[model samples]
Target chain A: MAPPEKIELKKQAQQLIEQYDNFLFDCDGVIWLDEKLIPGVLETIEHLESQGKRFAFVTNNSSKSRDTYIEKFHRLGFKGIGKHLIYPTCYAAASYLKEHLKVPAGAKVWVLGDHGIETELKELGYIPVGGSDPRLDDEFHPQHDLLKVDPDVRAVVVGSTKAFNYMRIATTLQYLLHENKSLPFIGTNIDRSYPGPEGLILPAGGSVVNYMSYTSNRDFIDVGKPSKRLLETILEQRDFDKSKTLMIGDTMYTDIKFGNDGQLGGESGGSLLVLSGGTKLKDLHHLIENPASLQDGPSLIPLKYIESFGHIIHLLSN
Target chain B: MAPPEKIELKKQAQQLIEQYDNFLFDCDGVIWLDEKLIPGVLETIEHLESQGKRFAFVTNNSSKSRDTYIEKFHRLGFKGIGKHLIYPTCYAAASYLKEHLKVPAGAKVWVLGDHGIETELKELGYIPVGGSDPRLDDEFHPQHDLLKVDPDVRAVVVGSTKAFNYMRIATTLQYLLHENKSLPFIGTNIDRSYPGPEGLILPAGGSVVNYMSYTSNRDFIDVGKPSKRLLETILEQRDFDKSKTLMIGDTMYTDIKFGNDGQLGGESGGSLLVLSGGTKLKDLHHLIENPASLQDGPSLIPLKYIESFGHIIHLLSN
Candidate 1:
C-alpha cells in the first residue's frame, strides 16, 4: 500500500487520546536510554496526565527488576509510575514453563537470571534455585553445579545475567538433555541482542536459551514479547477492548506485527510505529519490497507516525 | 523419485575409486565416534585399498589435533594413517581473514580456541593474542582492553576454549563492535553442540561466534564443513570428478546436504544417507512424506541397511 497518511494518523491519535483511559508505553528507546530521556517525552506524558490518561511503562528487559525501573524512571524525571508497571519477565517465565511442562506450584526451578525472573518464579509458588548474586565480588563462582543432574529440578528458567559461564551452561544443558524427568527449558525472550552503553551487548539470556536448545536437541518456549503470551497477559490485566485498543511502539518485528493479529487479545487491533529506534526507515522499505520476509507474522501498518512524543501529543491536542 | 537402487550406489563408488586415487573421509559418525567403526566401513576401505585407493581423514573437530586423531585411529586398528589428516580450525582462521578482510600477516588475532586455531593463525602470520593460558592458571585474561579500541588488530577468531568467560567474550565483542577497525568476525564451525564423554557439551566456538554476531550486530563467515569454502577446499583437494563421486554420511543436514545442489559450490553432486547416526530411519520416512522439507537438496534415498560395520562388510563382500 501507499505510505501511511500522516493526516489520518494524527486524527486517529486524537480520537484514541480522547477515548482510552489507560495507556501502556514501552520504555527502552521509547522514553529514555540509560539516564537521558527521549526529546519531548516529559511534555507528552504531562499532557496525557493532564487529559486524565493513565499510562504504565512496559519493558521486555528482564535484567532489572520493576523496582529498578521505578527508581530509574524517577531518577530520569518520570515520577508517579509505580512498582506495578508491566514487565514481561515474570509473566513470560511463568507462562513458558506452564505451557510446555507440568510445572505445578512449588516445582523446583534452576534459574540463571536477575531479580525479575527469580521473583516471578517464587511468586508462582515455584522453588527458585541457582543464579548468581550480583553483589558478590567473585561473581564467577559456580553458583550451582548444573552438571550434576537434580531429580527435583523440574525446569531451567533463563533470563538476563552478567555472569554467564560456558561450562556451567554446558553442564546445565547436559542435565536438561539426558535426564529422564523431561524437564522443560524456558527462555524469557529471543531478542538476539540488546542495546548497551557500549553499543549492543550480548544479551546472555537469549544466548543461554540458544545453547540449551542447540545442545538438548529441542526447542524451548519463548514467553516474552513477539510471542503473544506477554501481550495476552497485558490484555487480560487491562481488560482491553480489542476493537478500540491500540499498540504503539517503534519496532515492526515486535510491536506492530504483534498487535496487528489480536495477539494482545481481543478480536480487532491496531498499531503505531515511530521511527525512533531499533527497526529503521530503511528496514521498513526493505520489508515493503520483500513481504515474504514477514511471512511469520502480519505486515506492519502503522496507525500513527511521529518523529517524537511531542508530535504525538500536539496531534492529540489539535 | 523412487529410491536409488543399491546397484546404482555401487556403480557410482566404483567409478569414483577408479577415477580418483585420493579419497578424503570425515570422522565422527562417519568412520567412527568413540571406538566402534560405522557399518560397512572396514570392508569398504579394504575394497578401496584392494583397488589401490588412497584416503585421508578430515574432521571439523579441532579440540583434538591431527596427532590425536592419528593416535585414535591407530588404536582403532586403522593402519598406515598419518599426520596429513586435515582439520578445519587452521584453514578456517586462515582463509576467513585473508578472503574477507585482507588481514595482513603478523596482525594480533584474539584467538578463542585451541592449539589448532593458534597454529593455523601463526602459519598465516597472525600473532595469536588474547585468551587465557590454562597452563599458567591465568583466569581468562584478555590480551587487550575492550574499551580501548585497537586499530592494528586484525580480527577475532572464535574456536573451542576450555576456559570460556562471559566477561571476556563481552569485552571482546565490545572491541570488535566499537574498535578494531571493523575487523572480520570468524567462526571455525557452526555445530551448536557436540557429544562429549559426560554428555552433550556446548560448542564454545559456535556459541561465542553467534554471541559476538548478536552483540556486535554483524554476521560472521563460518569456515568449517557445511560451509561453501570448506566444501570447495575438500573438493579441490580430492580432485574427484563431482558427477561420479558419491558423498555418504549418516547426518542428512551437514553430510548429505553438503553435496546437494543448493550448497555453495555444490554444482555436481550425489548423496547417500545411512540410518546409523544423526538422521534416523524414522526421520527419513517423515521427510519422504513431507517433500517440501527436502527441497533445494539431493534426493535422499535409503541405502543398504546395516546395523554394524561387520554387517556392512558382509553385505558388500557378497
Candidate 2:
C-alpha cells in the first residue's frame, strides 16, 4: 500500500474539505487534550459548518455523560453543539444493551465505570448498580455484601473509572463469572492510554476494560471506535452517506481501522491521521514500516496525514 | 495420556508417600483456605515428617514477606517452618533482581504491590518506591508528584494489592513506559483468582500484573509457579532431588504445570491434584476430556487425583 498522503498544501486541504460532507472524530486527541481545546480546532469546525459539512464528536471516554459533554463543549466555545452531536462509549454501552442485546427495559445493569454509565443506563430505563455507589469506596472485605452476584443484573458494562479499587473489581468479577459466565460483558474501548493534561500519558478506559476482561477470563463486546457495530449504528442513526464520510483520529488502530474496515470514503479512502494527540509522525512511520506487527496490519494505515485537525484551518487560511 | 490415577486406597497412599522423599505444596487450597487449616492436613504433614520426608510451601501470594509467612505458620500451630522453607513470589521477585537480573544493591525498585514486596526488596538491599505510599491513596490527579518517574528506579515489580487505585497504576505506568519501555517488568504470578474466605473467589496478583502488562503493551517476567526459573531456583536452593519430588495443589495451570514441566517424581510422574480448594472433579474431568483446550495440553493434567491433601492421612490410618 502507498504511504498516507501529506495534507500540508492549501489545495490539498481544500480537496479534503470538499471531498467529505460528514466527519467522525475521536475526541481525546483529534479535537482536544483533556479540558483544553486545541488551537484553531474551533475555526476549522466553523469553516466546515460554514460549508454545510456535518460532524459528530465520538469519544472513547465513558466517564462523562452526554449532558456533561455538552457543558464541556459549550465551555470550550463550541456553539449549538447538542447532545445528539456527541457519542461517548457510555451511551454506546447502554444502547448496546437495549438495542443489540435486546435486554428488556428496567432490567438491572451492572456497571464498573463512572457516573456517565450510571446516568446513561438510567436514561435508557435500566437500573444501574455497583457503580459510583458510596459503599464501593470502602476497604476490601471478603464478606462485603456487594461481592455477591445480584441475580437481577441482566448485563455487565465496564469502562473507565478513576475509582478503580479492589472492592469494585472483586464485586464486578462476581457478575462476569455468574451463571457460568453468561452475562453480556461490554467494554468501552481498547486504547491503552490517552494524552492527558500537561502532556501526561494517562491510563485510558481500555486498560480498565482489558483488566476486567483478563481477570474474568472472558471476551467483552467492544462498543467504542474501530468496532464495526458502533460505526454502523452511528452511520445508520445519523443517516450519513458512508461513501462521503471520513474518520479523523489521533490513534491508528482504533480510528484508522474503523474508517478503513468500515469501507468509508468510496474511491478516495476514508481515514485521516493527525499528530495533535497521542500519535506522532514517528509512530505512524514505524507502523508503516512494520505493518505485520498488527493482526489487521494494512487496515490501520490512514489514507492521509496532517499535523492536527486544527491545522486544516491554518492551511486553508494561508 | 491416561487420566490421573485416583489415590483413595491405603496401599496407594503408602506407596505414594514412599515414592517421593520431597514435596512442594501450594499454600492456598491444598493446605489451608485463608486463616483456617483444612482438616487432617497437619496430621498428614506430621506423618510425612515422621518418615523423614522434606517439604516446602510455595505460594503465589506476594502480599506477605517470608518473615510474615513464618509468623503465620507459627500462628497456625506449625513448628519449625522458617523463611527458607517458604517461597512466596515477593521473595522470588526480589531475589530475581539480586541474583538473575543482577540489579545492583542500593538501587531503587519501583513496586506496585503491598508492604510484602517493599519489605522483600528492602531485604535484598534495594530501595522500594511507589508502594504503600500514603500519597498513592490520594484521588486521581494528573499532576501528582509520583507520576514523574524516578530515574534511579532500576526495575518494576507488580503483584497483588487490595489498595489498588489509579494513583499507583498511573505512577507504575510511567516507569514501565519509561526510556521506551527499557525497564525489566516482573509479575508475581498468573493465577487469575484464588479461593478466599466465605467461599469467595477473589482477584489474585496475576490480575493486577496482567492489567499493567496489557496497559503498557509489554511482557513481564513471571516469578511465580509454572515459571521454570522459579522451580529451578527452589530445587537448587533446597537441594531437593526433582526425581523424588511431588507437587500438591488445587490449581491445574500453575501448581500442576510446575511439577509436570519440571519433570518431578521422574518415571512415577508428579503433580497431585486436590479437590479441596478451587478445582472440582467436574473441572478435572472437563480438562481430561478436552486436553486440546490448553496451550500445552497434557502437561497441565496431574499424575494423580485425591479428594484433598489431608485425605492421605485418613487413608493411611484406615
Candidate 3:
C-alpha cells in the first residue's frame, strides 16, 4: 500500500483557520506536560477563542475530576478552558454507561479506579464501591472468601489505580463470572503503560483488567480515546459538524486515530499532529516507509504537522 | 470414527491376576468415598496381595501429603499399603520440578498450596514460600504492590488450597511477568471441581491455577491425572514393564485416560473402569452413542468394566 499523503496546512495556507468550527484537543503532550505549559499552546487557544471556535480538552487520565483537571489548566496558565470543556475518561465512562448501557439508575457500579471515577459514578446517580475504602481491605491479610458480595452490582469499571488488589478482583470476578455474566465489564482505557516520574513506566488500566478478562475470557469495553466512544459521549451533549470539526493531539495511535475513527461515522475527519508532545518526524517517516505497521493511526495522515501548538499561529490569517 | 469396544475379562473367564505384576489405583472412588470404604475394595486388594501383585495408590488431591494419605489408608483398613506405594500429585509436583525442570535442590519453590505441599518441597530440599504465612499477610490489609519478592526463587507451584489469595497471585505475576518470563509455572492438577460434603461441589486447584495461567498467558505443567506427568514422576524412581502394568480407577476421563496416555511411549497399557465409584455402563453407552463427544479420554476403551473392586477378586485364581 502507498504511504498516506500528508497535506501541510501551512503550505496550502488558504483559509486554514476557517475549516473547523468545533475543536477537540488532547491534553497531554499537546497543551502541557508534567504540570508545565508547552510553548505556543496558550497563544493558539487564544487565537481559537478569538475566532469563535468551539473547543474542548480530552484526556485519558481517570485519576482526577474534571474540576481538578480544569484547576490544573488554570494553574499551568491555560486560559479559556472550563470544567465543562474538560472531558476526562471517567466522565466518558459515566456517560457511556448512562447513555448506551442505560443501567438502572439506583444500581451500584463496582469501581476499580481512583476518586475521580468514583465521583463521576456518584454524580451520575450510581452507587460506587471499592475505591480507596480503608475498610474494604487489610494489609496483606485480606479474607477474600469473606468479601461483601452484592448481587445488584450492575457493572465493573476499572482504570488506573494504586489500590488494585485481589479482594477487588475476586469480588469483580464473583460479580462478573459467577453471579452475573451480563454485568458490563468496562475500563477507562486499555493503555498497558503510562509515564511515571524519572523515566519509570507504571502499569496502567490494561494490566489491571487483563487478569479479570483473561479469567472469564471476556473482553472489556474501553471508553477512552481511539475507541470513538469518548467522541460519542462528547457529541451526545452537543451538536457538531463532523466534517468540519478538528481533533488535534500529539499522539498518533489514540488522538489521530480518534479523529480518523471519528470519520467512520459517515463523515470526513480533520486531524492535526503536533510534534511537541509525542510523535517525531522520523516516526512518521517510519510509518510512511511501512504504512502497514501502523498499530493505531487511521488510514489518512494528519492534515497538518508542526513542531508545536505555537506553529499553528503561522498558518493563521493573523 | 468408531467407538472403542470393551472386552470384559469375564467373557474370556481367564485368570486376570496373571496379566500384570504392578497395579496402580486411583483412590477417591476406587478404594473409598469420603472416609468410608467402597464395597468389595478390601476383598479385591486382598486377592491382589495373595497373588503377589504389587499395588500403589495414585491420587490427584494435593491437599494431603503421602504420609497423610497412607495414614488414611491404614486408618481405613488397608493394612498392606505403605508410604512408598503412595504417589500424591503434590509429591509428583515436587518430583517434576527436580527431575524435569531440574530446579536447583537448594532453590526456593514458592508454593501456593497448603502445608502438605510445603512439607514435600522441604523434604525434597527446596524452600517453599507464600502458602499460609500469617506474618506475610495482615487480615484485610494486603499491600500487594509492596510484596517482598525474592530474586533467587526458581519456580512457582500452584495446587488446590482454601488459602489461595491475591498476594500470592500478585507475587507470582510479578515473578512470571516482570521478574522472569522463563520461570516454570506448574500446577498439581487440572480438576476444576471436586466433591464436597452433602453433595456440594467445591472449587478446586484448577480454579486457583486458572487465574495465574491466564495472567501469564502460559500453560502450566499439570502433574495430575490425565496429564501423564505424574505417571512419569512415579516411573522416575521405579521401573515397571509398562506392558504388564494395569491402572484401575473410577473415572474414565482421568484414570482411563491416564492409562491410555501412559502407553504413548510405545508400550501396551491396561485399564479397568469400576462402576461402584464413578461413571456407569449407561454413561459409556451415551459416549458410544456420541463417540465424538469424548473430551479427555483416549481412543482406547477399558479392558474390562466391573461393578466394584470386589468383582476383581472373582477373576483372581485360587
Candidate 4:
C-alpha cells in the first residue's frame, strides 16, 4: 500500500545486477519507442550479454513474426540475441496451441489477427481460416457473403488488427454463441493501447478481444502478458533458475503482473519497471495520491525503477 | 408475484376494446410478417375503423422512411392509414435531434443506418454524412481511408444496417472517443434479432448499435421502442388522451416497457402484448416459475391477449 521506492540504476545497483542471471525484456516501451531504440538500451543488453547474462525480447505485438522481430533486433544493434530468444505473442499462441492446448495438426483455428498470427499457425501445422484473406478480411471485397460458422474451426484466436470489422466480429460471435458457447477463444494479448509512431497510441489487441467478449457475453484465453501462457512457454523451453530471472517491462500491469503470477508456477519471481514510455511517473503519483479512485487496477509495485532501460547499463558497470 | 391472468382474447373481450380509443400497433409481427398480412388482422383494423377507433404504426426499423412505409402500407391493402400516422425510429431520431438535442440546421450528423435515417435527417435540415454516401459507406470505394473525426459531426446515429461494417464503426468510434467522448450518441433501435423471411432471425439494428457502444465505451440514447422518444414524438404531434390510448405490440420487452415509461410524463399508459410473435407464454411461464433467472426483463403483461391480431376480429364480432 505504501509508495514503491524508486532507485536510480547507477547507485548501489551491483546487488540488483548480480541477483538476476536471466533478463526478460518487454519491447515496445522499455527497449524502444516505436521503431527507434531507447538511448543506451542496446548497449545495456550487449553489456549484460558480455557478463554472461541470458536475455529474451518479449513483445505482445502480434503483427510481426519471430523471424521479423529477430531482424529488428539486429537492426536495432541488440547483439547476441537470436530468433529463438525472441518471444512474441504470436509465437506464444502457436506454442500454446501445440504444447498446452495440444491441438492436433491440421485442426482448423479461426484467426482474427494479421499475417504474424497466420504465419505462426502455419508453422504449427494448424489450418487457419480468416485473418489474412482479402475476400474475408477486406470489407469491400466481392463475394463478401454472410459468415457461415465453419464447423471445422475448433478455436477462435484474436490479436491486434486494423481490419477488425463487423463481419469478423459477427462471424466470431456466432462461434462463441453457438450451442451455448462451447468453444475455445484465444487472444494474442489484451494490451489496451499499442504504442505507435510519433508517440501516438492506438487501440491494441486487448480492445479487439474485449469488444468481442463484451458483445458475445463470453470470456477468452489471452496468451500474451500479463497472461501466464507466455511465461509458461518460456520456462518450458529453457532451464533458468526462477529466482535469478527478472522480468523487466515498461508496464506495471503486464510485465510486473507476469512476474508475480509466474511465482505460482513454483519459483521466486522478480520484476523491474522501466519508465521510458507508456505509463509515466505522474500517473502512478495520481494513483498514489488517490488510491481509492479506482476499484480494480495495477496493484503491483515492481522491485527496481529506472528512467529507462538505458539506465540499467550503469548497474552492470560495477 | 402471481401469474398474470391469461384471457383468451376471443372468449369475452368487449370491455378490452372499449377502454382505449387510440390503438398504437407495432408492425412486423403484430400486423404482417414481411409482405403478407397476418390473416384476419386487416379485417380487425377495418372493423375498428368502422367503430371510430384510431391507430398508428410504430416500428424500430430505420431503413424505411415514412413515405416508403406508407407505400408498403398501401401495398398491403390498409386503406385507412396515412404517412402522418407512422412513427419509425428514424423519425424518432430526427425529432430527437430537432426537439431534444436541438442540433441546428446545416449541422452535420454522421449516420450509421441506411437511407431512411439519412432521408429523415435531410428533411430536418441537418447535413447527413456516412450512411448512404458512396465515398464513406462503400467498403470498395477508392479512398478507404482511416476515419478522421470531423469536428462538424454533432451526433452519430445508428440503426439497422446491412452495410454495418468496420469502416462505419471505426468512423463512429473516432467521433465518440474524441475530446474524451463528449458527443450525443443516438441509436435508432436496439432490437437484437430481426425476424427475416422463411422464419429466420438475423442480428438487427440493436446489434450494430451495441457493437459500436461496446467498442467506444460510451452509452447511447436509443430513440426507438423501449425508449420513450417514439411515444414522446406521438404526443407532440397529436392530441390523444393518455388514459384511453394503448400500445399494442408483439413483444413484451419493447412495447410494454414503452407504455410503462410513458407514465412518467404524467399519463396513464396501457399496453398489449401479442403472443403471435417473439416472446411466448412458455418463456414468461419459465421466468415466473424461476423468479430469478434474470434481474430485468419483460415484466409487463399487456391489458389484452390474443393469439394474433387476426384474432382481434373476434373481439369486434361482439
Fnat for every candidate? 0.40, 0.81, 0.01, 0.09
Q: Give the DockQ-based CAPRI class for model 1.
A: acceptable
Please identify model 2 stretches exceeding 4 Å from their true place: none
Q: What is residue A215's positional error in candidate 1, in angstroms?
A: 4.0
Candidate 2's displacement at residue B274, Å, is 1.1
Q: For candidate 3 chain A, which ten residues in a row score worst on lDDT?
A: A193-202
TM-score of 3: 0.59
Candidate RMSDs in order: 5.8, 1.2, 8.0, 5.1
State the C-alpha RMSD over the true interface residues for candidate 1, after superposing those residues: 5.0
Worst 10 residues of 3 chain B by lDDT: B137-146
- B174 in model 3: Cα distance from truth in Å? 4.3
True contacts kept of 4: 0.09
lDDT by residue (tens digit), candidate 4, B1-318:
334545465554565667778878889888887787888888888877888988788998888999889888889898757888999889889889999898899999988889899999999998888887676545532134546667888988988786765566656666777776787999888776644455533456777777677666568998999886678678667667667787878766677667666652134347776777665777556656765555554345444456777776865565
Between candidates 2 and 4, the one scoring higher on TM-score is 2
Worst 10 residues of 2 chain A by lDDT: A194-203
How displaced is residue A74 in candidate 1, in Å? Answer: 4.7
Candidate 1, residues B1-318, lDDT tens digits: the string is 554334334454444345445444557666775466666676677777777756655556655656666788788777877665455555656766776578888788876667777766777778876654443233333343443455666778776665556655665665566543276677776555554443334443566566666655577777765666776666666565554454555555555555553232134345555554445566666765766755633344433223322344454444
Question: Candidates sorted by DockQ, descending order?
Answer: 2, 1, 4, 3
Give the winner by TM-score. Answer: 2
Against the reference, the lDDT scores of all candidates come to: 0.60, 0.93, 0.69, 0.73
> Whose lDDT is higher: candidate 2's or candidate 3's?
2
| Model 3 lDDT per residue over A90-145, tens place | 88888778988999778888887788988888888999877767654553222333
